[model samples]
Target: MEESKEREKEACQELPSRRDMISNLPDSLISQMLSCLPTKEAVRTSVLSTRWKTLWLLVPSLRLASHDFPDYNSFVSFLDKSLDLYREENSCLHLELVIRKDYDDDQCCVTRWIDHVARHKVKHLDVECILVKREFLEAVPLSLYLCESLLYLRLHRVLLVGSESISLPRLKTMRLEQNVYPHEAFLQFFISSCPVLEDLSIVRKDDDNVKVLRVHSQTVTSLTLGFEPGDGHMLYHYFDREILGICIDSPRLKYLNFNDDVSKCQILSSFISSSVKVHLGGVRYMSYYSGGVVFSNQQVARSFFRCISRVKDLVISETIMKLIYFCMKVEPLPQFCDLSYLEAKVCLVDVEMLPALLESCPNLNSIVLDLTRPTIITEQITAWAVPQCLLLSLEFVEIKCCCKAELVGMKLAKYFAENSVFLKKLVLRWRGYVLEEDSVLRDLLELSWRSSTCQIEVYGPLKRPVRV
Candidate 1:
């Protein structure tokens, strides 16, 4: 029985092995197959056999993702090791490098990586340039102009080259990102040099610099531009003398969008340029930088009233209203007073502007006052008497951050009860400490007396979900 078992085992072992020897596999075939898998998986195949060993070194493309590496230095080290071990099978490379670090390191390493890929005759490259450190001090050089063989390029969170030129002869598509600047000059230079370029998308940075970014690309048939400002620092560089501006010049621009602040960048009224007129008629949507900067002076506020026609809908910041009141000294309307919709940040001075503003926007209907600081609002709104106006289309009115002594709230409720002819709904969202509570209630009740016939909803302290 032992002899028989041994013979069977020998028979099984003697059978010609079906698996192909690693050394016998064609290098080209293995390399091509490895190229299809992930970089990690491709490298893991080397453990199978010695012939498969060098196959991963032939992967034509390398991707060192940011999320995969804990830090930039680690990613750089991994990249260096991978590149050092890379074999000739990867004659031409299609590399994508995305590093999550500061722009400084990106500025330093980008050129080196680009050069490495170019040396390997890389054809497709997608890289996310980031700063590792020295974020404010360093600048990225325009060395990408040397990648002649690159076919597709995407830049994100990278420094913008003011006017440096980039020529990618084989390049077909160039997508500038949304998060950071892909400077107008750099884009212009890139497009100008890429004669055969077919597709281009510049998801523009958020800024008010209305100096149209010149894009010269007749060959670019498909263009998508997010031309408006973003949720950038509205008050950033508060002390800086230079106000940021965005100027775009793309004659053949087809798919265009200009989205305003994402509801957070309360840039106040100064960001609006009355002298500037945008003639982008066929625009898909006029979205961004719409609200305003907080005006510190009444002159600025009054000027805003004149130009309110330019803005579709406005969230009047509290500061701007104060500025208006501070500057308000019984002035007449500026000129264009066709404002229809307004969301005010209620202040005492806002009352001063309201007389003229309401008079001007005769077509005005809805007004939302967003009040954050109860004390400031109380003082601000209390300072001015209610502007008398018989609003025709007026229906909805929301008063937030209401305190008892906020004399403006009582005045507003009283005024509306007296004058808001077409008024249908009013939400009084109030908040205050113990002593001020009764005063607010009394004021609201007084306003109610004015509008026994008008519908009023009072959200008093701890009454409704009228969070300040």
Candidate 2:
């Protein structure tokens, strides 16, 4: 038996080795594959064989993070050598470079690299420079605004100083997060220069030096505006410097996501499309009087709602729901004549307001409720006037319990099951820790649904099987 085993091992060793199929692929395909990897890891492929030695330099994209290296000097050296080789050997048709790091060593290093890439006709560039101290922010080179080859650009925690003649003709998507612009006109000019821009996202800080942001692009299709509160000592002065408002004039706009607590108002106009989708959250008004903060002013809230009343899809946050509930006391919500889909995040105690909000969307077809933060039920659920959509257009209803199961959520579910006339599917999802899982299922199963053919689907915790 030992002699037979030895003969078999010898025969296997005598067989030819397997071919390296991956290495045999075309250099263009191999470089494209390496482009998906980090620049450091891509460069390490050089040691694989002589064929791969110079292949990484041909990669169309480079993602460099300073933390990936032991020190800043090594990172700089690698960038210098790699980019030099790429410029000499590879075609400049497309190049993407992403740099994310805290560059405190030499501020000029970042600007120099950006200018170099801009000159080389970079197609995509993402730079996120985190500062150790928030007092000083590095400014992007003026040359970047003139890179006509750029298609996508994302900058975070940088200062954008506009030039007299800013030109990025091919730019399609741009994101500016926590960036500092010199003034409001500079920002408007910066955005107007991108003639073919389609998507734009801006995350404002408390002291971004822009009071009233105006977006006046005729070609933009999607826009997202959000706010980030200051930290530590800056929080003490937050209430003193709230943003006045935002004005948008994009005629081709299809989507808008507005999430800002500081902005007092939002004005949207020139919307030619009636099928716009809107996501609203953290919109409120706070007044500082007698050394205390008070939230009031329903007029601002009402105006905000009216601006988005024509949207086809609406997603409202819990804070905005509370504001709407209070605003309803002073004035009624505008009719959402075109709204068909609604997704709302509400607390259990605030579920009573859901029907009133739904009544405004007369043509609603689907509703998704994200229920959370349950409070003790002390009073009966308020009787709501039946919404027009519930009787005619409502078809799909989904209730997601983001927290532990509660009687209020079940009651809301029961209310929908019995009220929605044309409902086709009712979904109930909850966590597994609730001891009343079986009881909840029994109650739902026994309820008399308004729709004769309504289908009920129950989902428990992911660890457990689905209970129909």
Candidate 3:
């Protein structure tokens, strides 16, 4: 039996091994395999064979995260060893470092790591730091600003202290969130430094010192500006009521999201802009109850809508709905020839602007109206003529409201059912505020359908299923 086992083992060793097939792959492909793994796991592959021993060093991408290490000291040691070994052989195309600044040594290590990557020709760089102390004065190394090879960059919670001059020649996309700047000029200087930046996002925190934000990028296509307040309940305490102004002048800008509640907006240029699919004037739960923002009679929102009049797709929120309602009475809104889809909230006080708003969008196709609360339409409907969109372009209609308010909900539903010539589908969902009979479904089915192929579907309150 021993001789038989020995013979079988010898036979298996003599046969060609399957592991040799993977080992025979090209060095470039093997390095790519190591690139997809975490730095620690990639280094562990060294025990596989001698061919993979130096394969990790040639990886074009490196991501070192401190959370994967046991302690801050170990994390620093790993970065020192890995970056040194990687620098000797080849340069990296992408380098991402997610570090936490808990100790004083962490800032020094991060500075050195930034210096190392700048010299190694990193094309894409991202640094995310969680500052343990809010008042930590660690500034990003000035060497990072001079990295001409960067194509994409994103920084979060990193401070840019006094180093005003920035010259990133090849950068295209950049995002700075919770990053501290000395003043508004520093922010503008950092933005204007990138000549070829196409997509940019700036999120301002409560600690930022800038009062007025001015964007004058000629090449930016997508831009988002948001403000984070310090306190949730008390808006006047943390937010400056001085009416923050946002001046924009990007001719090539296509997508813009100005979702700040505490600021006033101003557009400098009359450039054609693309659409944004967002809830325009919605606030957080705490902000809603606090009643800190009031745009009902403000001209700031009017200017904002006038600038984005050429938008192809629009979504109006409750606050913006009120603004449009009030603004329509004073001045005529810009003709929204580019608008194709609109989602709006129809309330009691703002129903008068519905017809006027629909008239502005000559090319609108679909509309969704939320009639959840009881809207007291005290004034009679004045306009009897249907809009041009309802006759030619409008197709899909969806309405959501309470079942008890069927009288008011069906008024809009009957209008759509009788008017929409090209209507494709109409969906109505009714939830009950109190126990009431769901006669809406039966009544809607009996309405006169304008389109030949319009399908009507209704969903009532869901009933519990009984188990046998």
Question: How far is 156's C-alpha from truth in model 3 (Å)?
Answer: 0.7
lDDT of 1 by residue, 1-468 (tens): 999999999888766453554457688877778878878778778787666766788667886686677766777787877776755555446778776664443435665666566666678777775433224322334456667777887766555545455557888888776433444455556567887777777665444222334556656655544433343434432222232333333344333332322111222322223222222111222122125443333343354345334434444445444444444445655543344456666544344366555664556667776654444332343344444335466666777664544455655656655666677777666665432444555555555343334455666666653221
Best-performing candidate as measured by lDDT: 2
Cα lDDT listed for each candidate: 0.54, 0.76, 0.71
lDDT of 1 at 103: 40
Best-fitting candidate, scored by TM-score: 2
Backbone clash pairs for candidate 3 read: none
Off by over 4 Å in 2: 1-25, 48-51, 88-107, 132-135, 230-233, 268-273, 283-294, 382-384, 433-442, 462-468
Q: Model 1, residue 312: what's the lDDT?
A: 40
* Candidate 3: segments with Cα more than 4 A from true spot: 1-17, 103-106, 131-134, 162-165, 230-241, 262-288, 291-297, 317-338, 344-363, 368-393, 398-415, 422-445, 453-468
Backbone Cα, N, C clashes tallied per candidate? 35, 0, 0
Better of 1 and 2 by lDDT: 2
